[model samples]
Target: MTKVRNVGGKITETTKGNDNSFAKENITYNSQKKISFTSDKGIKHGKPETLPPPELPSKCKVEFRPSKSWQGEFGFDWCRIGDSQLPVDKPYSDIVGKYGAIYATSPSAVFTIKPELYQRHLAEYEKFVLSAFGTYYVPNLSLMKGEIAVLDAAIEIKENPDSMYYKYDKTVFEVKILEKLSNTKGKHFNDKVLEIKCLKEFSSKQKIELIATKNKIDNKIGQINVLPNNKVKEIDILFIPVEHNGSSGTIKGKEITILTNALKQAYVKGNIVRHKEKIKVGGWWYDLFFTKKDDKGVVSMETSNIRSIHRALDDVFFKEKDNEIYKNHYRVYMLTNSTSLNGMAEDIGKNAKVVVVYNNRNDSTAPHELMHAMGLYHTFDNDGLFTYKFQNTDNIMDYTHQVGKDRFSTNTWQWKILN
Candidate 1:
């Protein structure tokens, strides 16, 4: 025997076995394409159904508004039973999406008349939503947060004017590997390590010339105008320390200073500032400016750890926004540390421009993750896992050695979109 009941907006279905035992199941419905169901132990139970459930109306003109408990950042909820779903009976062509507007019926359930109709309608709907929200729509290019290794690597610098020399001295350039960092368990890889690898050596005269060129780069950074021209005033950052209970945050004053200075170095080194535009610290007259605490310790607050980092960010910073102060400015959430995740960002192109970094000493992580938030894709991603296209890792966007990070490639048009 099977029984169905509605608790909240979720539909609970139960089946009685021949032995009189019962099992409860949760069902998710998408009125357009399919139905998905899961069991109590967080296990998926069935495939999506192609047809709408008999309980759902075949067609309606009025939009299905969600109850207070159902409305969210995305849209109305279709799964819950309430007065919100009233005005349910109307002509088929009167709603916001006209012919087809797929809506969430429950937290996990969506409804639409036809999948094809929904898809066509969704594209236009997204444009409307974005236009209404005043979001900068970054097309095609997207990025996600990932981990990078900073192994103790070295490259030999020979005496000549043909290559890069060691920063310390031109005479003694040694190639060696030392300490290693990992983002995953047991498994470790040097393939994605970010370190300096010397190529050609420079003579004393060439070194002088290099210094001159660097000065010119600095001049350019100062002379750059605003966006579209590849230069911005500064990228503001709010560096708040999150503390829960008696556990103080791992970030310290010295560490924040180190990270800030490192980012300034990376901005010049990454050439994102020199090549594309001028990026500086929030208030430091460099690449970024940040918030600081008087005590040099994290601000401790008591909040539900229900969703942990994300929940904490929302509660503390209001909500992440783009250009919080000026153009090219953003916010970052810092946590104690994590083994699996060094940083994370949305997969879409520059949606929130928000970033999260741990209390690690890796300076490159800042520019790397910041670039990810800025909608820049890795130079070489999934080289082995997929069919290998770009195996080079010298660029900051690549997972290989951090040699060419200070230089931007010739053709990175995606960056122009953000500007």
Candidate 2:
């Protein structure tokens, strides 16, 4: 076992059984991006592998992939890569020492982190944090479900009083000190003063939680929770993104900024919609890039005719399905100009080319359209395979997002048919 302690601001790990030299290298792992090792001291990993395709019920379907972006000669470009993580409907260790340092060199390292899926990973959260808090959660409930962001995060520098932060997946400062690892749970969690720092202000936004606390807590911040275990099976999503038609260029500056934050916020809203039992639908990870480039085959068009949009996307996505993109990736688009349709994803569409969307749409656009591409018929549509008489209009499949209570959930009867 390796003991992790903070030597000043640097993280130091001391091991007992094998060679303890892996901790001495100058390695950097950003909480927002991913945990990686430099070539000098890390184990040699084969080329990254992606998650297998999802097997949807004969009645419904979904898949996984990641959006890998890099700078190219033509400004910015993107492609698909293997999704790094997925949500497991199980409990995790709360021991802070049971986190990242021990398996620092291993590829299967797991940390109970609080992750935020940042728009373009390196993008700071000053504006987004302020806006979202102002819009949805200023003086909100004291304790709520923490699984809104796409992935997890950890602050390597605990002492730096920065104005921004990467999203944390598991840690809970309750907006104050992280006492979970210092002592036992009873004493740490009982302090109401910590929880009341709820709306504490930072440079531009109110902090939801602090990264780590001082003293013997080891300065490590990660939390993992075992849920109410009502689940029997699991399905993983390798959520991938692809762009076409110079789609990212449609909006500039604030248009992009506001829309980008809205999409991320929408994604957080989408995360709340899940099948907690029998089937746990999860696709929590995504990537947004600083540069927006189109896929080679995606045609640039101006009009919003749904069929024309689908055709332009289908031809390129289908033609290059094997290499540049995959059938599992959910393709996203943006255009120089758009019309009445906020976004579009075809119904009961089997292939990847079957579903596509313009990202510059409203905040409520994604999960609904994504479900269509994933083989779910609208609840009100007569062609659905299962009979579902929803008692209310809060279903995600319906166009009821204006109320902000729509959920991507189904009735017990619908669950039975699909499960």
Candidate 3:
């Protein structure tokens, strides 16, 4: 039988009937009697005694030590690599030893750490600390679910692809910290302070600015200001489906596909295509979500009676919670089987826009509601009583009951407002 020896608090073992080296490097074993090597000196085992924890350094260090022990509950809230943080769900051990020697441990996994491992960990850990103290975190990595950006640490040295690389992923972010904004129980966590701007649904003006910046980058312009031209661009549409009884307005059967095709057809039928072959592919790319229902599986439509239904869904489903992170996407609701008015598009709060339409509409409904979302008002003037002008039937914003072919003609002011 092999006897176990205690070298300080570290446990070591030797092979039976063999006086030689241990299975682990740097450890020595003996046969007739158990012996362990400490710093190339053989030492015999005695009664195990617990030693006091090692003292922590005033500042972090990089060199490894052999004689000293380490103390304190050193752990990291997150681990940053390149511009992204590894999705470590649990608190990770970040033990610091004498002379600031560091070692990181995880509850679920182990890493074959090199001598320089702690150096990288320390660098990333410093970024996390800065973010915890409220630093700007601009990440180049795509974010995960329930995660939000915290801060980024600037690196003086430029990274080379071959030497500095993550083994698992293609690219590693320099440093980024992120935290779950809400827990599984749907409770908000204020301590996880992170800011990310790209996920926001930008306005048309903001989108123009983004396009201008991209143009500046592409053209390699040293000193220039970019301005967007007056051309219709593709818009992102997040289609939140609110069905009363598995049907929207009056349209039933395959909500997403049918509605998508109908919307496409409406735009195509309106003769908005740029050319024959250069058809707009992402003219209205969408992400769909079903309406929230009660325990009885019935969707309540009464705004007065079922306010919670609206409130809960509105609170949860938004651009901020978007997993795909679409830029400048508009959140519109396709509320089905409504017994009320046809459709409405208005602002809910500051910088918040919502467009809702019932299902009983034709192909033109989606475009009409979309025009409202894009800042277009009805053709009929509504000073007190709605008065229809001669141009009302000639425009897409005209009332549905009007008697003429509707075109997508907008005045100069209207176009300026839309863009």
Candidate 4:
């Protein structure tokens, strides 16, 4: 049987087969055009991005780069490299040319940004999500791990008239690549290791200059930045367009920030451990199924006496065998345009998967509702009254927002559900 659903400005169609298999298709719309792509597992396309990248660069050179997936194949989820968690429903400002970077969305396919949506994505969106760095995912221009980045005409070799036999010893293409973040695997790639291939080929003039300076006075990229997971991120690499083509012939350009996917943490309240890792999470499989949008959508708990958004979601999250799907990991069912993120839990004896809704507006309620699924409750439900105490101010399950505090801390006693 085939079922169609429309929610959150997107359309999802699911089909179940006689053999008990499932296939889902998602359709999203843009005002000017519609862009679509596929993935092995469904993605939560429009979640708010709260985690930010490191302040410094993670430059790894050819010798130090990892051998597993150098080209960001695995979890390199930065927007520039490819799989950024950019919200799809936002307005894309198209302000650039046709030649933009096309990155791998899957091993078999890559997502290419249409030219109209180029600069808006590369410039504005990149900046909005980043405090520093411009989007530098352009191929050849965007150097990956193990890729040697050099300023073509940005830095011109100048003559050092004071030094004998060192005519054009001034810094050039190599100096920037050695120090600047061509790749940020989080190591300092700039101690100036000679690219083995060309060392012997250096003329006596270059050799004399190299031996004189050694490592004393070369370009400096300062220190490397590491992410929350204790690994240097490639997306944090920064490369300036300073060509030693000539001293006076320098070109003006913006800093191209490399992008990588990393999870962010809320340090004060470590309860949200999911986003604490700097490394991207892969295969922690979960799907976001949407219930049809309604004028009323899902009722707001603040206004409504009682609403069973969870039960509504469980009814349609999947029509086929429910136990088979949500057995291992719980599923998130979004009630698009809903005013509430609250939902009920798996009803007793229903064997249904726990369903959680996304408040298309305020997302603060998600973690709280998930806490319910993890077996938490209001401070107390005694006498049918939701309990409140000064201690409950930090509890995610409490109505702490009423006290003008947006808190996520949970008392140790309430966290026993995880064990």
Select the stronger candidate by TM-score from 3 and 4: 3
Q: lDDT: which is higher, 2 or 3?
A: 3
lDDT of 4 by residue, 1-419 (tens): 56776578865667674322222444445667756656577855474544443332311111212122122211211122212222111122221122213312123422232554443334321221111232222211112223332211111112121211121223322333333223322322333322211112121212111211212343211211111222222111111111111211111121001011101111011111111111111121111222234576732223242235444433433344633433344444433233443444443223333544433423335445544554555542321112232222334554655545443434323322322
Segments in model 1 whose C-alpha atoms lie over 4 Å from true places: 1-233, 245-308, 319-329, 382-391, 401-418
Deviating ranges (above 4 Å) for candidate 2: 1-305, 317-325, 349-353, 385-392, 402-419
lDDT of each residue in 149-175, candidate 1, tens digit only: 122111111111122112223232222
Model 3 TM-score, 2 decimals: 0.29
Q: If the candidates were sorted by their TM-score against the true structure, best first, what order would they fall in?
A: 3, 2, 1, 4
Give the winner by lDDT.
3
The TM-scores, one per candidate, come to: 0.29, 0.29, 0.29, 0.25
- What value does the lDDT take at residue 134 in candidate 1? 26
lDDT tens digits, residue span 1-419, model 3: 47865575554566667454223224444557665436456666774443322222111111101011110001112222222222211111232111212211113322232335334333332121121122211111212212223332222211111111111111211222243222122212233222322333222221100001121231110111111222324446655654333343333344333333323222211222111111111111211222336688854344333323333434444433542352245545556544444555554223334555666654455555666666556644332111223232223455533343323322223334444
Error of 4 at 225 (Å): 32
